[model samples]
Target: MIGIDLGKIFKGNLKEAVNVVNRVKEEHRSYLYSGIGRASILLFKDDFEKSVAFIEKIPPSYRDFCYQGIFYETVMHFHKYSPINNGWDSEWDIAKVIELLEKVDEKYKSSSCFGIGRGIMSFEFYYAESRRYLFSDLVWKSGKALEGIEASLNGYCFQGIGVEYGRKLLNYFFAQDYFQPEQGYSLDNRFFSEPLNKEINRTLKGDKTLKGDDRENYYEGIKMAVLENFKDEKVRNYILNRIRERERSSGN
Candidate 1:
């Protein structure tokens, strides 16, 4: 319900718009997520340092939200391969993003939790906990796989994708639902703001006919595939899952 001064921002007066957010935040510091989001808008519009400054003004606990990422372009750059952004410049100071996330992780570990001051932090952490996964060194791969999913879902033919890939896609959606149910329900809906429930429904049920031990085996196979391919270096489960799956299949 924060009334952002879009008029000031539309006039190219970012400072004024930011000041309005600051004043609003002062009165309602408990709900300062909107204010922090405003700063990110500026950051998206090429207002760099000041955006960071506004973010810095937010309580240290909430500063982690700042690191949650600002621009959709930045999010897509890491989370999707061929993302279509409205005004994303390739040369933007992506380092600043790393710097912010690093600072939040290294410096603000003990600060108050975002939304905790107002009793809403757990809701955010419960879903879309992207803050926990961010890093400066970039521990993830470009999501070219999203294209494969979209194509398979929208494509007329099954394209001979196996049970392993099918389970991987479904597992991914389940995890997303656990984090952000809305996004988990439909990638195109959450990310692209498109009405795409038909494709999403089709994808979710793409493997519905498989059952029993066959289904279990397929799920296990996809789990192994994801760990071996997309897992971060720090995840101990990657090595363990591979070894365990190998032993389980070999009857060792």
Candidate 2:
């Protein structure tokens, strides 16, 4: 709905669209503002900086939401290239987005970063064609590894990954190719454990004080993401072992 309106109102006239959104009541502008952010990208598809400048023109109250949309679209753009053959091509997008994210106010940075994580992993599953391709090879290969993102935003990013991962696991009908029992492709332990383990490891190492309930909450989200879909003992146990190793190291 917001997208439809944006497409009609934003037909090469950013100021006209901005003026219209500015007049909309504050109570109903969040999604609309985010849509405007997405529109900025689409309108300035040839120039990333122009998109950023357009987002800056939005009111401060809603600018972060626009930034969140930008984060998502930027991530999608970054993943378009094949990780194996086009590794160098995508790094610039990540680096530039991180620089853009750093400019977001602290209050909004968490949400924006979370959007990036969710946006990236959403495609990870979207690109999966079968059980052998159950998870994103790009993610597993560290092609879109978010090493450059701020450390404090790690929890939100993990939560974003958890949300998409959990949702994907539940799509038994829609994603039968990846979830069906008879696919004969063993669900590799790395597919489930490696990314979660890697992020948790980085989080703890970067901030050891991120322990107890605060840390466990993120781990629990990761656990719940898979617990329902993975009933096999080996798969469940493997995830537990990986998490437990980090849990013990963190003195949890």
Candidate 3:
């Protein structure tokens, strides 16, 4: 079996390795398209060098997934895009897969990388949103992907992301197709609301100009303004729950 140690071997020549992986993807398209072959089996069966080669081709935006230390997850990322387009848990290999997942959790739990999410879901920046698509094509394409691991990503990966990109994501609400007459799309309000609220809170907290309740009142007013898009107070309250959900999602 290829095992996980191959990450070190392939690191020396990533570009050449990527070319080789492209060969596997192109040469073995049929293997990927078949029902039984869709599992990680096809990738696992490949030569170690070839598997690593395929992995090297993953986008630079997903650089956080490189084989530096988080090797298995790096492998899983490419596996998603490889001929084997799905995960496998056959009795023979299920234990190995479980071991890999535990490793993934451990690695992410202690690490801190602000760009990790934009790296993992950067594609979402341009094309997909996890809430809309259960898993964006880009997410599955990464193979080793997961959503909001350990809640640590809130500050490091997501909450700290660029406001411009965040604004683009928020722009979806203004779209004719997304904004409904019945406030049906209120669920999406937090995509922008949370960030805006966070910014408001940050500014208010830091402002020497506004003291005590003055700052608190200013922050509250900004939150109410965000609710302006929702004519119905009930819907606005529901859509604006993200601020509260942060702690819940974080399990704090």
Candidate 4:
């Protein structure tokens, strides 16, 4: 839908985009066929006041998803919107996102953070698998996103990341049972952290090992860059120790 919306907006079809949203709305109140269109206008063209005004006009039940779409698109398309050319400047992108998210109502914040985390880890896996970035670079890039986020909301982000990785590695049913949130299942650090540990273990198997300062920096980067704002000592230590254990077991 992003592609369709992008084309419509690029061609100055703002009314067309609105008509599509309205058309979908008429079919079902809960059916939002395309959010990326609204998100693009929010992030690229509209100011915060306009963004807020636009969202205010939405049904209260649907506003949270609006915030989620805006933040998700911001993170999902970081490379395209990033200030740097041919390189990631995640800090710049993160700051831009947080500036808007911070002002959002507290009730809607967690969903947006979840989108941010999901967005970062999706690209992390993409860049790592495609060899578009070194593992170290990927760590730093994701760290920038994690670092700028609120400490309390980081788990929501991690849950999103875990859901992404779980979807790739596990069957559809298991992914929901384990990672996807539901009435009985709340977002927990373990739900997300464990999957991340598994992903790192698999990724490291075929990747070059970081040695000396590079190695230390890699772990430290995970510690400081990723966990500086995250206050869960148990989860924080668990991730660091797990990586060290994997490094030792593999004879890195």
Candidate 5:
């Protein structure tokens, strides 16, 4: 996984950082099919240039079967919206993000496999950008949208790119407090996490009566429990670990 240091960005100008993210959002308004995850990693990182350069070295034709358009779109969207300078601008930051994405594309094409490396790279970039605007109001809005998408995507893909991407999104949302205990808003943690847990329990208990919001609430409660209880590990990691253990025991 590509790790990002968000604490570094918080020491700088937070307002300006959020404004830049908002700019990117406005530029890529057309491509949004669902909510985008907001994370500190997306906002700040000193080694952004190095990260971009490394990913850019990859060819453009590479295909990320796991995330498909997600990798490309995320980079392009951020690049298109990022500010050239810390000041103001009507133009897009396409040059920088595109350059890096091109490298990602190349690397994927060379490997002939959609490795997690590309996804990690994209995530690092996103996190760095997001960190800069962590305290901004935009984070709340974007974070919620991201959580919604994640919950919606769950159970659709068991393994492979879809699952990986879903996990990333979940982690990002968790980090940003999108799943805050009892926080009201579209990004409320209950929407996805709680529902999944309920469904899992229902399946285990052989309870068919639990459906819709009831099942969703059960999952939400589980998510809240995990978040509240697990302070050291990330929410995604906790969930994935359980899934892995279950699969192993079940011989799946």
Candidate 6:
């Protein structure tokens, strides 16, 4: 797996890393591997323009698998380098980000892409609206949608969605316990919360009780629900511990 030590690269001056990434592109290679690496370099540099440019050049066939990896690395880099209290700093140009996302949507279409597309769409939606949407609307609304797509996609989709829900749930918990309800801390609460519960219900509907490894999906769904309902550090640690436990058990 191709990877970069983002922590090491973005430790000091972020601009220096951007320069390094820009310099590397002079090599003139445009393979999927090269695109992935270059995209990482641009993201670390916080050069959204360069990153989007590089990513847009990649063909659609390679994009389904590759784009998610690139986006995950970008988010991870931002989380480490420019985080706010519970979220990343929105320093990059939103218009540029939106434009890139539109390109991503067009290139990948909606069919045969499944989790990766949903994952990108989720993050983009969160970034655009400051809240998460229901998994069904995010993953299943498009024409010619994939069936059983959630099970087939990478665990990252579930994990990432869990993290976002966790963040929002913490916000809701904090607001109810301390802040004013009129403040709208759980902005878009209904959109995410309702479907989250519905997913758990659907998973266990009829005779399909969550069992064996299938239990993980149910747990992930529950974890997201809990994340939406709590925000304390204790709750955060507990949820994270549960996720780690599941990962270890899965041997992934």
The best candidate in terms of TM-score:
2
Model 3 residue 248 CA deviation in Å = 3.7
List TM-scores for all candidates, in order. 0.27, 0.52, 0.25, 0.48, 0.24, 0.30
Q: In model 2, which regions exceed 4 Å deviation?
A: 1-8, 11-32, 56-61, 79-93, 103-107, 130-132, 135-144, 167-252
Overlapping backbone residue pairs in candidate 5 total 32
C-alpha displacement of 239 in model 3, angstroms? 5.6
TM-score of 1: 0.27
lDDT of 4 by residue, 5-111 (tens): 44236344444544555555353322252264245444455366665555554556666656656666666644332424445444435666777778878998987
- Which residue runs does candidate 4 get wrong by more than 4 Å? 2-46, 76-93, 132-144, 168-252
> Candidate 5: where are CA atoms >4 Å away?
1-106, 110-160, 164-196, 199-238, 250-252
Q: In order, what is each prediction's RMSD in angstroms? A: 16.8, 9.7, 16.1, 11.8, 16.5, 14.6
Q: Model 2: number of clashes?
A: 0
lDDT of 6 by residue, 1-252 (tens): 222333135434434433444454533222223335434545547665555445444444444434554554444343312223343222222233233334455444222132332334335445534543332332212111212333444344444443333444444434334545454434246544344334333322311222344335434644655555556556355545655565566553
The digit string of per-residue lDDT tens for model 2 on 102-213 reads 7666877876776676676666556553323524232332224566887667667655555555545445332433334454324454443444344434323322334454
Comparing 3 with 6 on lDDT, the higher-scoring candidate is: 6
Whole-model Cα lDDT per candidate? Answer: 0.33, 0.58, 0.34, 0.52, 0.33, 0.39
Lowest summed lDDT across 10 adjacent residues in model 3 is found at 30-39
| lDDT assessment of candidate 3 | 0.34
The CA-based lDDT of model 4 is what? 0.52
User: Candidate 5's residue-wise lDDT over 140-233, tens digit each?
Assistant: 1222222222233322211212223333434554554445445532313566566445433322231122344323332333343345334445
lDDT of 3 by residue, 85-165 (tens): 132210111233233334433443322222232333344333335334322133223213333244433333322122213
| Better candidate by lDDT, 4 or 6 | 4
